[model samples]
Target: MAKKWFLAANKKQTDGNRMEAPQRINASDGINTSASLETLPHVLFADDDANMREYVSCLLKTQYRVTVVQNGIMALELAKTTRPDLILSDIIMPGMDGIQLLQALRQDPRTHDIPLILLSIRASEASKIDSFDAGADDYLVKPFTPPELLARIKAHITLKRTRNQAYQAIKSSEELLQSVFNGVPSSIAVYKTCYAADNSIDDFEMFLLNDLMCQSLNRPKHDIIGKRYRELFPTASKLDVLDLFKEVVYTGQSTSFERWYETNGKNRCLRFKANKLHDLLIVIADDMTAEKQLQIKNEQMKAKQLEMEARQQREIFRVTLRTQEEERRRISENLHNGLGQMLFSIKLNLDTIDLSDSLFSTEENRKKLKNAELLLANCIRESRRISHELMPSILEDFGLEAAIENICSQLTGPCNFVAEIEPIVPPADQEIQLAVYRIVQELALNIVKHSQATEASIKIYDSNEGFINATVSDNGIGFDIQKEDNNATGLLTIKHRVKMLRGNIHCSSQIGIGTAIKISLPKTIDTY
Candidate 1:
């Protein structure tokens, strides 16, 4: 059978125009060529001799699914269409030799990855080298045993399967990583460092940009990707961003910082965190413009509030001093006009009387003396009344409760006034006691002069928490507190007194209904 196959090959060469029939090898040569039980790896075998095709197919049938092609042309076509797991071809063929076929398969992407082996009759070093150069994965010499053929085929097929699985795993991992990078809320980007002639990093080229990064720059990915930092942002040099990235890369450490930039005529603040990732640098940025603006606004508000409070305090002090001066002036005028005139009258009457006039010398003379004596007594009483009104010594001598009760008894008008004074110890601080007395006096005067109420009540009591609470209410023609001028001298005095004591007061009034004034003062003032 071997001799016949050789004879056919020689005749095919002589018939230059028409090819001779190739010999075929039959399984009847004591080889068990049964079909494989499981799914088998595909193999494409190419050879010009029909006998060699049949022999190789019969040998591999039990372990693999074999496709026999008569020449390299048929083998190449079958390999591309079927995408076989392995290809076995003879070096010598009638059309398109194995070396040329191997080169063609390697160039085509679809069939390039398929494992290929070359079968040759020539065993010279040149031929083996030529096969490998043409991209053959394995080579076998002619007259090789079936065992050797099966082993080589199994080894190549197993290797191809393992390589394919690894490629798939790597692809999947890359896809997962991409998903996570883009899914983050902040802007994330990857950059490749570009170095100058001196081996120092001069610039950076954008390698990857997530969706948020693209949006933050207000540019599309295609425009930003593969572009240098300066190209994307003309002002990058001023920001010194290249220096920051270089520092991180050189130190192999992570750093975070804040940066401000102007984009589309609006200022923006960004907080950036950078770290080195092997040959690339990764940056994550958050937009802090809104937060920074809010902080600035809050600071402005606080400053304004402080200024207003200081102004109000100054105004209160000025008003208080002015009110005290006006009270002193009015008191002085009253003393000079009222008591001083009466004293002059008494002096004149005494001067007219005789130095040693006998008692009852004449009826008219006695009457004049009695009248002069009465005038003297009246002048003395007037002087005492004016002095008491000025300071109300009752407050210092009898305590706050007695002073309040005495003031209430003096309220005589069309209104029926009631005083509910709780018995309690006077405050230790003279200033506190005076403050409470003045507050009550102001409220009672306001109700009597303005309120025109039929009934009025005054309440003074000590709280368990070391506070004095005073309330004065009247059923009068009430006034709208909101519409009333708060800077009125009377209300201003009340407010200033309350503030001085570090106390609080509330005045509630409604037109034509009633008015209620509540004041709370601490028992002791803090000196410090």
Candidate 2:
């Protein structure tokens, strides 16, 4: 397997004259690293030699943005943040060297899969093997011709793109698995777990799924519940998979892999993983058997769908739904589990203390009583905030407009709240209302949190699609939407929920100017 390498790009793609490849010091091919259909191909190049970085940059500039770092420390730092499509590094330098950098990257999930291409003057067979053992995606001999290096790059890049495209095609081919719960048609051993009320994964009721999951392992989920990845999959030899999972969990990045193994004594490869929509792991597997044949019609349909919508919108929708559910669960639990208990205790104390008793009668006792009452009031306010954040209780009592009005008034930012709800939105469905409110809430939070502007506006007007349009705008510094990092998980969640409401969310932002989010959603019947 080629060691994961990464490339850095400033723009989506470069445009210029296609210069011949620069003379190379070293390069190698990768086996386990490449781009996926769901993610764009990114890359990073590192070298202490400014001339070399520039030369390589000039040669690859048309295809990739060449990041020139003074040393490996900078490379590692940039790699964590940029997560380029590929990594091209130099073998020797001050502070951190390529070998050390590669080792660190291997240990970090964010950079592990990036195809790493090493460059240096001391190129030998032994050195090449050492590079491979250390996990270089490709190794090129020093003083090598530009043509040869480019050929190798082309081959490795080509192989990776091919593999990912095949995996995506397979996934699209099997989209009918969209039916939730009855079965995924995919090889998922789901039994039942005590799913959290907020739908976040509190604990997997492994006992129920024990039989199904362990049927593959001959071991139960109990043994694997808190177990490490290496214990679960002896085949996961690369540290990258372990490192990757941690990064995914910590940073909320979605990663996928294709695993090939023998099932039923037959060799098969599975569309192993997909974006983490919620607590559930989305996976797909198909048999490569002669008897288990797929119809030509089905294949045609899969290919067509893959070519068409690809359900990228659905992916976004699922992520948003899962995020909202998770957020609600967290906030509710904080209230119910934390503030709720405290408030209950305070209420009990109040009830137990008789107003007619001596403790309540004295002038000093009265002051003490008044202070206790104030403390209890604060706790009540905290609980109310938590509940409102979760699912404004008022939204149910009154309609969406009144609830939103209350929310706007409570918003602590300096911006004044202004709203226009015609006929007061005519009581849209619960899901639709929640979606709109949540979107508005998140937008408001962003303004309070990031946008350093003074005032903003909110309007809910009817659109031609028989849906309402909610617009939020501010005069804050805007960011490049395309440049938003994959680590911007919050934005992804927002995008997802908008999709769930069968709505369209469009954002227009300009640096030093301002930002605007226009949400157009169809009105659905109430979920509550």
Per-residue lDDT of candidate 1, residues 364-405 (tens digit): 566667887787787788777777676779999998878888
Instruction: Give each model's clash number.
Output: 1, 37
Against the true structure, what is every candidate's RMSD?
A: 8.0, 38.4
Q: Which candidate ranks first by lDDT, i.e. highest? A: 1
Off by over 4 Å in 1: 1-198, 202-238, 260-268, 287-290, 324-399, 410-416, 423-433, 452-454, 461-468, 484-486, 496-504, 512-514, 520-528
TM-score of 2: 0.37
lDDT of 2 by residue, 53-88 (tens): 666666664444456787889999999998776677
